[model samples]
Target: MKSRHIKAQITSFCFILPALTVLALLLLYPVVTSVFYSFTSKHLIKADYEFVFFKNYIAVLTDPDFWTSFLTNIKWTITSLFFQIVVGFLAALAVDRIRKGKSFFRTILIIPWAFPSIVIALSWKWILNGVSGFLPNILVKMGIVDTVPQFLSSANLAFPVLVMINVWFGAPLIMVNVLSALQTVPRDQYEAAQVDGASPLQSFLHITLPHIRIVMGLLIVLRTIWIFNSFDMIYLITGGGPAGLTQTVPIYAYNVGWGLKMLGRSSAVTVLLLIFLLMVCMLYFRILNKWEKEA
Candidate 1:
């Protein structure tokens, strides 16, 4: 019996070993290498390098640009997330109550998410371009401005525009998730609330909100991480431009590593980002655990 059990364990290990090896090579190796590089003064082309220990971390922490980038990331994540959730929840509620053309509305609403991010970014870029662009030309024609305003180029306008674009792209995901969660909610609860003369808003607050609370929490955590780490939308639309006003941490890391050829410092930035994300995840889980306990 012991020999048979040992053979079964060995068979399972054999089945899983190849996947484990691939995971180690692809994920673990790069993470370990990045950590090692973060402690050194490595450059892209330079052959000679020296161990700098905490120097890179110290420089990054003291740099005003890093803090600016981090703040920008926070603003982007939070603002976009708020709009996405609100819009998505409302859309889900509307869709849930409607009976006709449901599929059509769902299809149209989800197009933004289904479209490629790069394509959407480029399309918005063209529309917002100050030089002979479609939307700006129309705005000028309507006497909204004397000249076509550079929406993506202006420091004051760029971040908010990016957030709006992100909201458009991200809201569809939340809509679909919330819609699914809404479907799973027991219909009898709402019916009972209605029998008790509960108003629509009251019913939603007491019945709907509690039912979808878990889903909303999980979605917020997931979207927060995704938005915080987002790079392509900002990169394609503004290239972190107009004097780096829109540069998030990923963009900063890319600029340092590839643009400036300071690989070690870039690795350090990456490590810091990882640490920040880990902390955020931990906080989210702690909050989630607390909520579950209270429930």
Candidate 2:
């Protein structure tokens, strides 16, 4: 029996070994290399990388562009996550308790999320384009704005448009998850509360919100991290343009590494981003764990 158990453990390890090896090579190795590079002067064409311990990091920390991205990320993260969670919850509520064909509507709405991100971004770009587009034309027809609204072209307007697109794509996940969680909440509780003369709002606040509060928190944290590291929509729409006003941390890193070939600087930025995300993940998981314990 002992021999068979040992053989089973060994067999399992053997099965895991291939995946472990691939993970080490593809994920761990790149991470280790990036951490090493973040502290050095690892230029693109340099034959020898001089160990300039923390020089790249110092540059990154002190750069104005870094601060810009940090601020933009903060704003984007908060506003986008707010809308995504609120809108998604409302959508889930509507779908979970509704008339006939609500499930079909739910499926149809999630189709935006299923669409390719680049396609969505570029399609919005055309809609917001200055020269003869549906978005500007409608606003002009409605007499809302005397002009085309300058969504993509203007720095002030570009970020909001990007956020709108992101929220549109991202809200569906939260909606689906919240809808599923709502299904698990006891219908008997809702009925009992109703019989006790509890108003709909009171029932929701006292019963529904408490039951799903942890899931809501989880969704908020997930959305925050997702929006914080978002790259594609803004990149596809503006390419971090209009004089770099819309460059988030990810796009900034991309520009530094691929565009300018500043490998070490870009690596430092990537390291910082990873660290920030790690902290957020820890907080999120801890909250979820506590909720589990309480439940």
Candidate 3:
């Protein structure tokens, strides 16, 4: 019996060994190398390097650009999260209450999420173009402005527009998650509330909200991390343009590492961002655990 159990354990390990090796090579290697590179003064094009200890970290921490990018990241994540959750929740509620053409509505709403980020960015860019874009042309015809305004090029407008675009792209994910959770809510809960003469709003608040709260909390945490580290949409849309207003941490790191060829400093930025994200994950789990306990 012991020999059979040992053989079974070895068989399980053999089955997973290839996947474990791939993960180590692809994920763990880069992370470890990046950490090592963060402490050295290395440039992308230069071969020579000197050990810098904490100098790169100090420089990154003290840099104004880093702070600006960090704050912008915070704003981007928070604003996108709020709008996505609100819009997605409303959409889910509406869809949940609908009986006819439900699948059609869901498919249509999820189209934005299915589209490639680059494609979405390019489409929005053309639509919002200062020169002969559809939206600006319409506004011009209405005499809102004599000439087209550059939505993606204006510092003040660019960030908000990027945020809105992110909200559009991300809301579908929240909608799908919330909708799935909503479906799992037992029908009897609503029926019981109805029997007790509960209003529609009351039934939703007392029955629906509690049932889906866990899913909502988890989704928010996941989306927060994704949005915080997001690079592609904003990069494709604005390229961190119009005086670097939309440069989140990842974009800033890319600019530093690739554009400026400062690999060491960029690695430091990456390390800092990783640390921040880890702290966020810890806080999120802590809060989530407490909520679970209370419930």
Candidate 4:
């Protein structure tokens, strides 16, 4: 019997080995290669030099453009996360509580999330343009402004618009997540609270909120990490334009290698962003661990 159990374990390992090997080749190898390249100058001309230690890193750190881009990334992450969670929670509650047309409304609401981000950005671009655009035209008609809004060109206008666009596109995902979490909640808990003379608000605060605390916390971490590394929406919207007002670390990384043709500095930026992302994830994980323990 022991021999048979050992053989079964070995056969299972054999079956899983191929997938493990492929992941090592595709994911692990590239990550290791990138880390190695970060230490050296992989320039286009003159014999590529050996490890430059931290020179490229130092240069990337001191660069003005890097700081500008870093700030843009922070603004995008904070604003988008704040609004997305609130909006998604509200949407989830609305959809879950509705007796009529819940499925129809949910299907319509998730359309933005289903559409490719490039298409959404392009569509919004046309809408927000100062000239003959849908949004600006509507704003003009509402008498909110004297003339059409110049969002695409103005540095101030561009960032907020990007945040709003991001919220529209990404918040649906969180809504769906929360909606799924809501269904698992036992009705008896709410009923018990009501029997105890708890107000609707009190029942929601104590019962509904605690039951889904894990889901909300997980989504917060997920959104934070996602927005930090996000590239497409911002890229297609402003291309980090209007005097680099909307550039992030991803854009900065692209400009470093492709724009300046300096592979070393660009690689440095890539490594830095990766490290920063990992740190943010770790911090979130630590907080999440504590939060879950308490929950």
Q: What is the C-alpha lDDT profile of model 4 across 112-208, one tens digit per residue?
A: 9887878988899888878979989998899999888898889778888888999998889999999999998899998998899999899889888
Cα displacement (Å) at residue 29, model 3: 2.2
User: Which candidate gets the maximum TM-score versus the true structure?
Assistant: 3
Computed on alpha carbons, the lDDT of every model, listed in order, comes to: 0.92, 0.87, 0.93, 0.87
* Per-residue lDDT over 1-295 for candidate 2, one digit per residue giving the tens place of the 0 to 100 score: 9999999999989998999999999999999999999988787776677788988889989999998988888888888888888888899999988889897989887987897878997788788778788989899999998977888878788878878888888889889999988987899999999999999999999889889988887877877787888888778888887888788899999989888888988999999999989998998899888987987
Model 4 spans with C-alpha error above 4 angstroms? 1-7, 44-49
Q: Cα lDDT of model 4 overall?
A: 0.87
Output candidate 3 Cα RMSD.
1.4
RMSD to truth, every model: 1.6, 1.7, 1.4, 2.0
lDDT, residue 80, model 1? 95
Cα error, residue 131 of model 3, in Å, equals: 1.0
Worst 10 residues of 3 by lDDT: 147-156
Distance from true position, residue 253, model 3, in Å? Answer: 0.6
Poorest lDDT segment (10 consecutive residues) of candidate 4: 41-50
Q: Candidate 1 at 12: error in angstroms?
A: 3.3
Error of 2 at 168 (Å): 1.1
